[model samples]
Target: MSVQQMPEATVPGKEYLTFRIADEEYGIDILKVREIRRYETPTRIARTPVFIKGVVNLRGTIVPIVDLRMKLHLHDDPHYGEFTVVIILNLLDRVVGVVVDSVSDVLKLQQDEISSVPELECAIDHESIEGLGSVAGRMLILLDIEKLMSSVDMGLVPADA
Candidate 1:
């Protein structure tokens, strides 16, 4: 889907579900969030990438879980604590879960509070970033979750035949 066609939490006050990876904060459009689930060990699949933690049966549908820490090349052996949870997302008509350190809070940001991400080389791919949001005294890396998840490198979807 085109950027303009991508779903957003843009109802006057845009809202984001904020979460942490290592020490940095990130946000995703709240509209794409299906549910927040506690950290659970998933059934492992053979020959998959390390970042692909595996899959879980969510009510019958098999949902793939990706560890954001590993995917973003953050912490290698991230400690799963009480706060660690999976943010299940509905993107491109598929259900996937992203493991995060902990959820912070839902933030509502006005247009002025959000700024374009500066063109720079970063560990996390810039294409995945929607923009940078300044709230309170913190900076949030707002993510285009759909683009990130559906990207070819992510291997979440099959390439066109």
Candidate 2:
């Protein structure tokens, strides 16, 4: 099909759900997001990573809750406040929730708005960074949420799963 004849949603650009962690803004593909819920205490699991806050029951499904701040090592002692929220994501046929400081607005960015990520030595896996998005004087660290969440260290999914 011709570019003009294609659906708007299938065009060159994509929409992202922007959120904040510490002072930096990050984004993930909007399609990965299932829902957003208020912060709630989850049932703690033994012998799990510190980043794995616990599991929460979501409509009969037990969903693992990950704290982005702790997972990315952004904060040594992360504080859960009123603005903290859980972003439920549909990943690899599994439902998982990630806690973020607060959610920003959704942005529909064209390909040109995204720039390649610069090489940097950091705690976050560089591969998980999709690109750097610049829009309206704001810069967003676009993430490949699936890659980040499915990595071996995360233990969210098995090698075959």
| Number of colliding residue pairs in each model | 0, 0
Q: Considering only N, C-alpha and C atoms within 3 Å, which residue pairs clash in candidate 1?
A: none
lDDT of 2 at 11: 62
lDDT of 1 by residue, 1-161 (tens): 65566676656978999999899999999999999999999999998888999999999999999999988889788789999999999999999999999999999998899999888977767889989999899999999999888877778888661
Compared with the true structure, model 2 gives a TM-score of: 0.91
Estimate, for each residue in 37-126, the C-alpha lDDT of model 2 and write its tens digit. 999999999998999999999999999999999999998788999999999999989999999999998999999999998888988888
Task: Please give the lDDT score at residue 22 for candidate 1.
Answer: 90
Predicted structure 2: lDDT: 0.94
Query: What is the lDDT of every predicted structure here?
Result: 0.92, 0.94
Q: Return the lDDT, model 2, position 103.
A: 98
